[model samples]
Target chain A: MEKVMAFTGDEIAAEAMRQINPDVLAAYPITPQTETVQKFSEFVAEGRVSTDMIRVESEHSAMSACVGAAAAGARAMTATSANGLALMWEIIYIAASYRLPIVMPVVNRALSGPINIHCDHSDSMGARDSGWIQLYSENCQEVYDNLIQALPIGEDRNVLLPVMVCFDGFIISHGTEGVAVLEDKVARNFIGEFKNIHSLLDIDNPVTYGPLDLFDYYFEHKRQQVEAMEKAPEVVKKVGKQFGELTGRFYGLLEDYHLQDADLVVIAAGSTAGTVKATVDELREEGVRAGLLKIRTFRPFPQKEIIQKLSKAKAVAVMDRSASFGAIGGPIFLEVRSALFEEQKKPLVISYIYGLGGRDTGINQIKQVYHDLAKAAQSGKVSQLVNYLGVRE
Target chain B: MKLKGWKDIPWGGLILEAGNAQKYETGGWRTFRPIWHEDKCKQCLFCWIYCPDGSVIVEDKKVKGFYYEHCKGCGICAQECPFEAITMEEESKFRKDQGGRP
Candidate 1:
């Protein structure tokens, strides 16, 4: 029987991992992400799940172990946040290169300097092009749903790639919300059995993995990875449909909210989308035409769908919690602008960088954005292409 | 074997054919080639024991000519031959088929 439980994003992620019962889980703990692996470890100790829990020394070793286990034909998984994700950067690429379907839950946190352990997009955005499917969650429920769906999306024959499920640190990761938890049997049946390809442990037909490709074949292999990423969206769609059939919650590359007919639109991902959604409703009730495009899948970045969604709007605002430094706006903003470049008539798009290092982004700020949009819509121009939110000027 | 294109090659650069690395003639890297003298004294089999790459051909408890295909010309066998039965010769001296010196 399906039941609703009040769970923090971290706790829900642990619950989902427990349901999947990955053959091996190799992880190093970091804050926000720590409670997840900690709770899963308790499950391991209690004999609730039969997963081989590898307590790796660091995030690098954690990913390395997951890569090894996955290559050896075990269903492998890991969870990390912030500096831990940064440390695993190198092997994260290797795991994708090897076409290993390891699903990792990354509790989004700021990259360090004047160190702060708070929520931001910098960590995952830094790894946007590392050849893994990235899923962004707006709430604890999406966090659970995304994690449950990751295995099938990645293990598809045409899309043998790793996946990273990202949610805001402290915001979603620490905050508790009501999530409808699927029964263990239903969850198991949804994922089905694991079928690996060209595993290292297939002793009958010996194979060599991670071979020295050199100039002769390295480019060709990279092309193969590109093809895999190209094939991922359709597979993600199919899996999402199947998951929705089992449960009642459907998923897609991006969540369309009040976007059908609107002059002003806001494109945002992660927990901030919920804020945008609430603010969009408020604007609509107050007789303002406002809508939101909540990004769910950020990697196989839904370019065509995004263009169709925002093409007719007078103006669009992309909310990025991470700074891009030298680039024009942040990561999502750059992509949205680039996607619009293909349209003959497109929205006047701008960037709003907000919520870095766990800064509070409230309803008033979102409302202020719509007010700015009202002015920009009438004036046919934006004063600034890039604006920082929840920060003093 | 023919070289493969991007689409023709296996995904992830996997080598499905196991132990096929032997086909690549690494002896091409050799600068000095070893000449084994069968007429000279002892067949102590020490060369067979010391040859790196298993290039020393062993038949019925006796040493035969070097395989030459895999020999890296390390001269470890020549150094181990107490009877001075092996000689290291300059590789570029011979033709491609080991005929007369160029």
Candidate 2:
């Protein structure tokens, strides 16, 4: 019923796109993300899919065209990384405000200033508040699976907002892994056809989009967007459960590995979660109670769940791959710390900024993090609340 | 129609029709009204071409009259008239002069 084959993350994303066969795809090439569109373009050339691939001149125009296509009652999709996502910033907000269910696969890379094209969370984290549902993948298998599930979650009548599927730039985007390719018919049947509630092309109904709204109604429309986001978590869970029925793989807002009865835990996201899992296994064999909490959904942040999971731990360390310049801790660290504030039994939490600009985060560095967590647990206090792991002091 | 609250307003507050703007009688906003003169009129149609609100009524290649319902009385037609055929007058004075028919 399913075929198992080795494929890169980019190829898996392309395969998902071919299976979805969206009505429109408008994208530009950026490192690590280029292969995704490149492979999709071959699908277009060879007549494997009927998607109208628009080779736009810039990322801004690519997102603009996606908004237009989605407004015109078509299922639109795109892919980008780093600066490409930065260039589409204005239209990104516009797309979400218009409430178009456009899906985008963002190959995560460091935002440029010092000009780095390496794996990091800066790009998507920069857009955390832009009213789009964000799903992070830990490996190639999850990347493919997330992209397929993104459709129903975003296109749901109650949650008509844009969705972004994020994976590490080079680590997961280029890394090859064995993936179970779902049958095209099964994917299609599960996703179903996109039906727009309000379409620009609906001649009889005649509606308008993206009009000027002053103080009288602007706040209400924004509140409506908020309500849609509030409704997303349930829709995402429902869709994930249904997808699990088809593929036998279940997903949740966060994945807990060896967390029960563990005294020290590490919270991380993306491909780094795999390394953390391996290190957790080793720590457990050595009789150390090290655990991991892997974040899967970042946008509609699982705040309550995060607090519940980390509240009883002796000490918690949040590993962030991106920096927040002047902030005391990184983005995820800030969120985790804030969430824990509501809990009476708050654990001693520390922030670790690591693997920025595509620096390798080996198992040794991860073991060091566990060692730090163990020390923090014993001391019941952290000497350095904010730390830079695997970086030159 | 009376708008009760923001919730009653459609999303984005978008107007659905192409020229449905005519539904709003902008004539109420008129401070100065345009008065057309037919005596020294050349009917060159420049006024019709330059009217921003599309309030200049034209039919069969001839200027019919101002569609006052949608006109904001911007005086664009009066400014664009070549033969001094139209003039801007205070709405109060014009209403008194024409007995409120002009």
Q: What is the C-alpha lDDT of each candidate?
A: 0.91, 0.89
- Per-residue alpha-carbon lDDT of model 2 for A1-393, expressed as tens digits? 779889888999999999999999999999989999999999999999999999999999999999999988999999999999999999999999888989999999999879998999999999998999999999999998999999999999889889999999989999999998889998888889998867899988787788666665688878878888888989988999998888899987889999998899999999999999999989889999989999998888888889888867999989999999999999999999988886778889999999998999988999898898889889887989999998897
Best by lDDT: 1
The DockQ for candidate 2, computed on C-alphas, is 0.38
State every prediction's TM-score relative to the real structure.
0.93, 0.90
Model 1, range A62-159, lDDT digits (tens) per residue? 99999999989999999999899999999999999989999999999999977999999999999998999999999999999999999889988899
Which residue ranges in model 2 land beyond 4 Å of their true spot?
Answer: B1-9, B12-49, B55-75, B85-102
Best candidate according to TM-score: 1
TM-score of chain A of 1: 0.99
lDDT of 2 at A78: 95
Question: For residues B9-86, what per-residue lDDT tens digits would candidate 1 score against the true structure?
Answer: 778888888887777667877888889898983879999988878889888988888887788899999999999899
lDDT: worst 10-residue window of model 1 chain A: A190-199
